[model samples]
Target: MKVLFCGDIVGRSGRESVTRNIPRLRQELGLDFVVVNGENAAAGFGITAKICAELHGAGVDCITTGNHVWDQRDIIPYIAQDKRLLRPINFPPGTPGWGASQYETARGQKVVVVNVMCRLFMDPLDDPFRTVDAEIAKYTLGRSAHFILIDVHGEATSEKQSMGHHLDGRVSAVLGTHSHIPTADSWVLPGGTAYQTDVGMCGDYDSVIGMKKEGAVLRFIKKVPGDRLAPAEGEGTMCAALVETDDKSGLAKAVRPIRIGGRLPPAG
Candidate 1:
């Protein structure tokens, strides 16, 4: 099973980059399933219904989010009905949308996509390790699913890396997000699971983690709250991971990061 996971979409530049390159990537890369983190798609806040539709139309199979999943008040009811859109599974019970969803490719291959936010330096949530254990127990790769993809959304790299090892042989891939900066450690674990510390943001790298440089610098220098953070308007670089998992054991056969159009150059 070949799958691609895009990092957080920061703003209009990120959306435009996805809109422009996803279709081509889908075909050129021979991707069977595509997952995108849309938490910061709307002005560097939360996602919206319209943005979700655009992403779906752009060949995204499932959209995952982190703490900012509810940034847009309008998404409250919409998330409840959209199975493709997911919030963190660690969210309290009765959360609007699901945290895990199963999707099928045109070839009749089943893929399970799950999102979990870590508790370290992040909003209070259920123990992610246990939460993922329960979710992985429901379906094993190669039997119930051709591929299982987990997006570890959090602030600490230590926590995300821990999740990757915890589900090493049990799932297909454990790709990290939420840091908005691509890391260099893209490799398949000893247990055959694909892992990356972060896939990075699909937005401009010229700014401070996708926000405008001037405003971000001002806030840091003065140690005072300044204008709200805004997404950089320059052309974005799409940072994502393309993984090919084994068909029999559902383990990762090959993994590489795909970065294009902005500051990052061929991080794969």
Candidate 2:
């Protein structure tokens, strides 16, 4: 299975870049499934129903969220109905929306998409490791879940990296998100799970993780909120990780970092 996982979609730039490139990308990469983190999809905040539907129509099979899953109150109703959008699995029970979803590829293959958020420097939620472990167990019965894609959303690379190792062989791919900077450590693990420390942001590369550079700089330098930061209007890149998983064993065969457009250097 050719699965492409894109990192957080920032603001307008991210959405525009995705709308412009994803259709072509799907065709060029021969992607069977596509998952994108929509935590930052709406103006660098949370995602909404409209945006989620738009992205889905644009070829993204599933959308995942992190700590910012509920930033937009309007999503509450939409999330309840949209099975394609997933919140963090670690979120306590009774939380709105699901943490994982199952989709059928064009060829009728069962693909499972799971989203988990790390506790380190994140919300005080349930243990992601335990939650995902249980979730995996539920799906692994008789290999019901053929292809598994895990989106580990967090701030700390160590936390993300640890989750990847924890899920190593059991999953098809474990890609990190939320840092908004693509890591070079895209490789298939010893156990065959594709792993990357971060998949980066699909937005303006000239700014700080897709936010306006001047505002981000001001916040860092002054340590005070003067004005709301907006998405930068610069050349953007669609940062993602491409992974190919075996059909029979459901293990990753190859992994590669993908960067197109923007100021970021090309990924080899």
Candidate 3:
């Protein structure tokens, strides 16, 4: 199975980029499923129902969120009914929306998408290591699911990398998000699972992690409140990962980071 996992989509620039490039990228890569982190798809905050639907209409099969999942209060109720939108699995039981969902491609193949958030440097939550184990156990090898993709949303790259290794043999792909900067270590693990420290944000690269440059500088330099940070405006880049996983074993066979448009250098 071929799957593409896109990093956080910042705001207008990020959304526009996805709208412009995702259809073509999906076709060019022969993607069977696509998952995008929508935590920052709003104006550098939480996602809204309208934006979630826009992502769905743009070929993204599932949308994942992190700590910012609740930034938009209006989308709370919609999350309960929208199976395509997922919050962190480690969230308490009463949290709105699900943490994992299954989708069938037009070809009739089943794909399982799971979202989990790490505790280190993030909101305290249920143990991710234990939580994922239980979720993976729900599907047996070679039965209900042929593909399983996991989105580990966290701030610590080390924790994310650790998760990639922890789920090496059990899941198809383990990709990281939350940090807007894309990492270069996209590779298939020894156990055949595709892994990357981070897939990066799909927004304007001209600013600080997709936020407006001057404001980010002010917030950091002055250590005080300034104008609200806005998503960088201008042409944006589409940052994501292209992964291929084995059907029978549900492990990644290959992985690569994809970055197109905007100002950042290509992944080498």
Candidate 4:
């Protein structure tokens, strides 16, 4: 199975980049499934039902979110109706949307995607390790699931790496998000899971993590609340990770990072 996991989409630039390129990418990469982090898709905040439809229309199979999953008020209700969208698994039990979902490809292959958030330097939610373990215990790779992918959204690289190692061999891939910078650590773990510290944001890199540079820089320099940071309107660069898994064992055979458009050098 071939799967592509795109990083967080920040704003208009990010949305355009993804919606415009996903079709071609699906054809060129021969991707069986595509997952993108849409937490920041709505003006550097949360996503909405309209944007979710846009992504799905562009051929994205599922969408995952991080801490900013609730930034937009309307999404609270809309999320319940969208099975393809997921929030952090560690969120309180009554959270509006699902934390994980199983999807079927065109070939009738089963794929499970889990979305979990880490607590270190992030929101204090349920124990991610325990929650994920309990959630994944229901499915056995190669038996119930053809591929298992987990999106570990967090601010700390150490926490992300820890989760990756902890779930190695049990899952097909453990990819990180939330930090808007791509890391160079795309590699298959010894246990067969593909891991990357961060897949990076699909937004303009010229700004501060996809935000307008002026306001973001001011907040850091002045140490005071000035203005709300807005998304950079520049052209965006879509960043993602590609993993091809074994059909029989459901383990990753090859992993590669993908970067297209904008300032970041192209990869994959």
Candidate 5:
């Protein structure tokens, strides 16, 4: 199975970059399934039903979100109707949307996508480790599911990497998001699971992590809550991770980082 996991989409630039490149990417990479982190898709805050429709129309199979998933109040009611849109699995029991969902490819192969957020320097939600362990137990690799992808949205690299290693041989891939800066550590783990500390954001890199440079800098320097930060209005680079898994074992056969346009150097 060939799968692609796109990092967070910040704003218009990120959205355009993703919607514009997805069709071509699907053809170029021979992707069977695509998952995108859309937490910051709406003007750098939260996602909405309209944005969800656009991403889905552009070829995204599932959309994952983080802490900002609820920044847009309108999403509260919409989330219940969209099973493809996921909040963190570790969210409290009554969270609106699902944390994990099962999808099928054109070939009728099953793919399980799980979204979980870390607690370190983040919201004090349920235990991600235990929560994900229980989720994984629901489906067996290679038999019940052809591919299992986990999106570990977190602020700490150590926490994300720990999740990757903990589920090394069990899951097909464990990719990180929310950092908005691509890391160079893209590789298959010893147990055949694809891993990366972060896949980066699909937004302008010229600014501060996809935000306007001025306001973000002012807040830090002045030690005051300056103007609200906004997404950088420059060209965006679509950042993602491509993983190809073995058909029989459902383990990663190859892992590669993908960066297109904007400031980051091209890679696949």
Candidate 6:
């Protein structure tokens, strides 16, 4: 199965870039499923129901969020009803929505999408390693599910890498998010799980992680909040990773990093 997972959509620029490219990418790449992270989609904060609808209209099959999942107060109601939107699996119990879900492609290929957050440098939530391990055990890859995509959202690279290695050979891909910067290491692990430290943000790259550059610089230099952070309005760069999985073992056969528009050079 061929799947494409895009990083966090920062704001208007990010949303526009994604909606513009996803349809073409779906046709061009012949993708079986598409997963998107919109943790920062709402003005660099949290996602909303409209944003979720837009992403769905743009051909994204599933949406994932990170630490910023609940920033927007309106999403609380929408998340409970929408099965496609997933919060971190490690979230405390009774949290609205689910962590992982199984979906079927138009071609009848079964795919499982799981979102989990790490503990280091972030919220001290449940153990992600243990949580995801138990989730993966529920379904046998290549038998029960044709593909599995895990979004490991976190700040620490070590934490993300640990999760990748921990789930290697058992799932299709274990890609990182929340850092907003894509890493250079994009390769299939020895165990056949495609891994990338971070998938990067789908927003304007000219500023500080999709934020207004001047304001971000001020906060660092002055160490005092003068104004609220705003999303950069410039043209955005769409960043994503494409993985082709083996239909037999449900392991990655090949992987490619996709970067289009804005500052970053176009990559596939």
Clashes of each: 0, 0, 0, 0, 0, 0
Model 3 lDDT per residue over 1-268, tens place: 8888899999999998887888997788788988899998889899998898788888989999999999889989999998999999989989889999888998888888899999998888999999999998998644688888899998998899999999887888899998899988999988888899899999999999999899888876796778888898988898999988777777777898888888887652
Arrange candidates, best lDDT first.
4, 6, 5, 1, 2, 3
Go through the candidates in order and give each one's C-alpha lDDT.
0.93, 0.88, 0.88, 0.96, 0.95, 0.95
Ten-residue region with minimum lDDT total, candidate 4: 219-228
lDDT of 6 at 22: 97
Each candidate structure's TM-score, on Cα atoms with residue i matched to residue i, is 0.98, 0.97, 0.97, 0.99, 0.99, 0.99
Candidate 2 on 101-213: residue-level lDDT in tens?
A: 88898988899999999888888889999999988887772168778999999999999889889998999999999999888899999988999999999999889888999
Q: Which stretches of candidate 4 lie over 4 Å from their true place?
A: none
**Native-vs-model 2 lDDT?**
0.88
lDDT of 1 by residue, 25-141 (tens): 989988899999999999999999999999999999999999999889999999999999999998999888899989899989999999999998999899999998999899968
User: Relative to the unseen true structure, what is the C-alpha lDDT of residue 265 in candidate 4, on a scale of 0 to 100?
Assistant: 92
Point out where model 2 deviates above 4 Å.
none
Model 6's lDDT to the true fold? Answer: 0.95
- Residue 35 in model 4: shift from native, Å? 0.1
- Candidate 3: deviation at residue 110, Å? 1.1
Question: What is the C-alpha lDDT profile of model 4 across 1-268, one tens digit per residue?
Answer: 9999999999999999999889999999899999999999999999999999999999999999999999999999999988899999999988888999999999999999999999999988999999999999999998799999999999999999999999999999999999999999999999999999999999999999999999989987897878889999999999999999999999999999999999999998
Q: Which residue pairs come into collision in candidate 2?
A: none
lDDT (0-100) at residue 121 of candidate 4? 92
Candidate 5 per-residue lDDT, tens place, 1-268, comes to 8999999999999999999999998998788999999999999999999999999999999999999999999999999988899999999998787999898999999999999999999989999999999999999999999999999999999999999999999999999999999999999999999999999999999899999999988987897768889999999999999999999999999999989998889997
Off-target runs (Cα >4 Å) in candidate 5 are none
Off by over 4 Å in 3: none
Candidate 6 residue-wise lDDT, 11-83, digit = tens: 9999999999999999999999999999999999999999999999999999999999999999999999998
